[model samples]
Target: MINKLNKSYWENRYVNNQIGWNIGYASTPLKTYIDQIKDKSLKILIPGAGNSYEAEYLWCHGFKNIYVLDLAHQPLDNFIIRLPNFPKNQLINADFFEYENSFDLIFEQTFFCALNPNLRTQYVDQMHQLLKPKGKLVGLFFNFELTEEGPPFGGSVFEYNSLFKHQFKMNVLEPSINSIKERQGKELFFIFEKKS
Candidate 1:
């Protein structure tokens, strides 16, 4: 049976503490990318931001306009507890596709892979819609086989390229050089600029 990775599904995972995807800290690849961004005022969104270590990292590093969105309330709750000073308004508990707001940058961590594979098209479209013109969608994507057995579903480089080629200008799609040990060679780092 196809696992419909919906809100309830995710909420249950958090309730059960079955989140193997939670790395407990901002991923090295994302941190390295965030470090290079010179625009501190960029409106940034981190969807499916479980534990939101990246959001915490961004806020701590002076990125004031950061937003953290999650389908499940458990993680967002944890984040608020961890970073109480973070703006309560920026902690969004909502479905990503339904959340309407344009941002200069969106950080993709496990969000795409966590969704059901059938939503790939919708994910791309929503991402395109959510980004400002010439804005970027940057992060790591798993470079593994796509199968029915996972919320951490995977896709090949060719598949990702084809799915995003039409709307995003490929700026940097390649093997991530600074992935954490657990994800060493399994992820593809990408920086896709929304096509103008």
Candidate 2:
């Protein structure tokens, strides 16, 4: 089994500034997708939200029902500092596996790949339980091979489909055309809706 990446493990990553996956701004593909979303009232959740630039972008664009959850307090604190007026209650510091809520939309940034491979199934189940009927899970998924050594572990289309298909009907799962230069060919932007 892969080593558990528990709260302290992640909190220390933040404390030591070891988060290499933090892109200072919202990802281009997700931002473009957000630009086309007409529903400002959608109850959106960004789980594993590290120093959430995407949540900041959503708030700036008038999406008021955004929930930003992270296991570590450091990043959440950083986020609140950046957007002091954002609803404090909406910033959750908790384990995704235990959090309960039904969201209209859930944004997946680097969350999936960061968990230990053994928890992938639990991650899928938790995500399935977190979305309202017909709600969508949207965001970028890294496309590459999985390896033992990674906080940024990798995966592919087949693995994603197998894990999500039982609960979500994939609406779109294809190479992201607008990935940032650094991730140009390594990300797949997807939209998967709950099967209910």
Candidate 3:
């Protein structure tokens, strides 16, 4: 049976223009994290990356080895229009779970919360598998209660700690101090390195 939250569900969301999770620009916490990274050549992946402003920022900052993957084509097309010079090959249209690749870093935004709660473990495991040794998975996660009525389902730091600790070294997981004004205090910034 196809998962209820599979491609069709997400595609419909894009088709209907119901992407409230899209912040329309590189979010502050993520931008700050990317700003301090000294290396410009690190391979990076941003899955479930709807109209990925972060990818655009990275590309503009000379991070050419950046990939933005999404199941729907609309956002990818929007990204292409927004950054016509961005390498076409790096705009991936694929399922995050089935996508196969290794990266120096992967960014998490609202992607995790958009997924079904039952898949949290799989999300963590896939993130581990997709990273190179010492690779980092970094971004913001919602800091609140999880509920069925959400694509923006919330989560807590304690839950994140237990989920990621076994496969990743939790380098940072704390309430985001620099989130966009609306998300401030309701999100946690995290950086988790794959456990060798």
Candidate 4:
């Protein structure tokens, strides 16, 4: 049976150091995307941001308004230790579903895959509600068959298209050419802009 996805489950993963989803540093695709962004003042958020290397990278690159939220505190604590200068107020330990705020951009990594499949529609809606008009939700999604047993649940282009088409203008949703070796061809790099 699939394990219950909750704060305890994620906290236990951190407690045991079983975070295989962590790639140790900011992902190359996201890093490159961030590099092209000229605006340092964008209001950014990373929900379900476990050991958020992306947020670290953004802050180090002069983006001051970045926020990181996770259900557990351990990973956020770890992040705080690594970046002592990162604003404490921006590091939130909260459930993503309960988080309420609008941002100019949101970055997705393993967070979406970590949720229960039944929450997919809610995920899309929450994303829509969180973004400012014409803002974007961008990142990688696993490209495989969805099954009953997974926290890293898989999905396909068709499934993504059907879920996001109404609320976002799908800009790109294709195989990630720069994914880490293990995820190459098994992930899609997407940019979905909230419909204005």
Best model per lDDT: 4
- lDDT per residue for candidate 2 within 1-196, as digits (tens), equals 2586899999999999998899899999899999999989999999999999999999999999999999999999999999999999999999999999899999999999899988999988888899999999999888989888887889999999999999999999999999988888899999999998
Candidate 2, residue 53: lDDT: 97
> How does each model score on TM-score?
0.98, 0.98, 0.96, 0.98
Residue by residue across 3-109, what tens digits does model 4's lDDT show?
A: 57888988999999999898999998999999999999999999999999999999999999999999999999999999999999999999898899999999999
- Whole-model lDDT, candidate 4? 0.94
Please give, for residues 27-72, the per-residue lDDT of candidate 1 as tens digits. 9999998989898999999999999999999999999999999999
Clashes of each: 0, 0, 0, 0
Q: Name the regions of candidate 4 deviating beyond 4 angstroms.
A: 1-3
What is residue 54's positional error in candidate 4, in angstroms?
Answer: 0.5
Model 1 segments beyond 4 Å from truth? Answer: none
* Clashes by residue pair, model 4: none
lDDT of each: 0.93, 0.93, 0.91, 0.94
Candidate order by lDDT, decreasing, is: 4, 2, 1, 3
Comparing candidate 2 with candidate 4, which one achieves the higher lDDT?
A: 4
How far is each candidate from the true structure, as Cα RMSD in Å?
Answer: 0.9, 1.0, 1.7, 0.8
lDDT of 3 by residue, 1-196 (tens): 2247777787788889998877889999999999999999899999999989999999999899999999888889999999999899999999888989999999998899888888899999999999999999999999989877887888888899999999999999998999888887899999999998
Off by over 4 Å in 2: none
Report residue 60 deviation for candidate 4 (angstroms): 0.7
